[model samples]
Target: MSDRDPQPVERQLPTEEARDLLALVRDIAQREIAPKAAEEEDAGRFPREIFTLLSEAGLLGLPYDSEYGGGDQPYEVYLQVLEELAAARLTVGLGVSVHTLASYALATYGTKQQQVEHLPAMLGGGLLGAYCLSEPSSGSDAASLRTKAVRDAEGSWVIDGTKAWITHGGIADFYTVMARTGEDGPRGITAFLVPGDAPGLSGAAPEKKMGMKGSPTAQVHFDGVRVPDDRRIGEEGQGFSIALAALDSGRLGIAACAIGLAQAALDEAVRYATQRRQFGRAIADFQGLRFMLADMATQIEAGRALYLAAARLRDAGRPFAKQAAMAKLHCTDAAMKVTTDAVQILGGYGYTADFPAERYMREAKVLQIVEGTNQIQRMVIARHLAGPEGR
Candidate 1:
């Protein structure tokens, strides 16, 4: 790590409380998260305790209602918090984003009784969550997921099939799952909140991923996993719509994370460039390197503005899906570009794990692929523009 402390980002928070919240997040991130990030991630160790600490600090539920232990903050504030956490460590930041995504179905669609029963523990009671949507056979084509949830004579549901690429997988306290309940396509699906310890539910080994290895990505299997009817998150056959809505918001979370990762890479590059001298002068003094840094910073700033604009739209209850898709597309692509540029700036050292540029590069690649692939984001944008492609 560079000896120089990274400068704090200047934020335009809406209120004194939000400003204080960001300060607290930076403190926790620096003192607690940043210190061990490189070591733990290198060891492929998941920091479960850090998430518990975040829960204790009320950072886990910022965008939810306070009535059920949430912080009641808007998406703008919540996503900024995500950006700070991600800048400290991608695992923590992305883990928090995935946890929030997992909570969305129930928080937004469940009955008041369901919310009262589950939201408190989920939001601030130290419990973690996973979202179950993608199956081995269905990733980008999620509407074709084969997982089935059959209603028994007792009205309880029996879920069967497997979910692939689950972020928190085996370790989550609960899973917000989508499974087929009616027809063969999107409309046939239903959502359920299954307890982590639900009978017959199990997780396969975590995938050996290229990056974000510390955050487990595993396949979750349901072998007739039973859940009470009350756990159903929305009206029957509404799961696809719920999942899409959650993705629209979730994509913004990813955009924030991508920018955070890019920012970290930029900070690392600047530190290296100024410290490493060539021909009796710092390479950063070279006009070529200076311009590279300038472009990287500009991209990062543009990505940040794009995601924040989408976030504000969400907070205003306006149509923001297209904007969210655009942000996800641009920000992740920018992260990939910026981090790769950082590695280029660092040259040989950047290619090695001795510095974080390589790690940032590796982590940034996944952002382009997660939440929704850049290709999918483009399709979503195009659909919004010219209408969906007809078969």
Candidate 2:
């Protein structure tokens, strides 16, 4: 048999360039992210400067086209980079994922003219973006969102409504907004790219979240927010399809970030268990603790494989929606379990803020909820396997 890479987490990278890229990301994660992650997270500080730094490093636009100032890396490379950043800090990892999601409409569906006008600044030019989908009245039932966008005789559209649970809400430079533009259903909606400084757009105070406090989530209000006809993405009444397509890719991003968080927690647990002693021996030396550690590692590895499998399907341009849902469901659930076990391995110390384990545990909980809840993922998978429920 041919010799294979001996590493357990051995990646089947596509090229030397991808390997170099991974190294660059790891360097940034260690030197810039990890050193301040725990402290800044405790302070609830949003690292805007770090994001700018990442933009400067050309880290934000990987997986998009090089023709439009993006790095043109594939989904596999882009996601592995996300994993590295997440291993350093979940906030940064998830922030990058959200940014990519926010840009998807313009990148994938916007006209050539539209891409030329806005894609560069939004992708890698130090500007941030937010996606507007969830509203106060509709989340799981998102097609029922009531945010309205009405067009005047001059063809200018005016939007009015509140979008809820927006990540990077107050600080985003632009927003990809979906609003109802026609009848009373999914087909009535349309998407628009709205500038952050628009006269009638505003953000409410950030929510008091249980975790990822450094990443703000808030309500954004649009009161007659007007935009030129040129700002619409895709055709009117196609917004729901665009949003669903974006989420299909976005769910995989969350899965990768979840695995990153789980890996970090597992590393912390192993470190603590090996260093801390119990009954005149290291706790890690005991069979029970060893089994727990083994289980955690196995779960993380399995989750990583699941997300990568989904990512590969996406890169190959196959139908990966169902796989994306599976990865998101499996990975986030595994993250919740592994992180909890990690805290258990560290005992009291893990429960304290002094160690990052407790914080990791808290952060892992949100993964199960965002990008669609686990329950929602289950429904998506079931719908794919079986037909939709009969009315």
**lDDT of each structure?**
0.95, 0.91
Task: In angstroms, give how far residue 306 of model 1 lies from its true place.
Answer: 0.3
Q: Which RMSD does model 2 reach against the true structure?
A: 3.8
Predicted candidate 2 versus true structure: per-residue lDDT over 220-239, tens digit per residue: 99999999999999999999
Quick one: how many clashes does candidate 1 have? 0
Question: How many steric clashes does model 2 contain?
Answer: 0
lDDT of 1 at 21: 99
lDDT by residue (tens digit), candidate 1, 1-391: 4487667778869999999999999999999999999999999999999999999999988999999999999999999999999999999999999999999999999999999999999999999999999999999999999999999999999999999999999999999999999999999999999999999999999999889989999999999999999999999999999999999999999999999999999999999998899999999999999999999999999999999999999999999999999999999999999999999999999999989899999999999988879999999999999998993
Q: Give the TM-score of candidate 1.
A: 0.99
Q: Looking at model 1, which ten-residue stretch has the lowest summed lDDT?
A: 1-10
Off by over 4 Å in 2: 1-9
Off by over 4 Å in 1: none
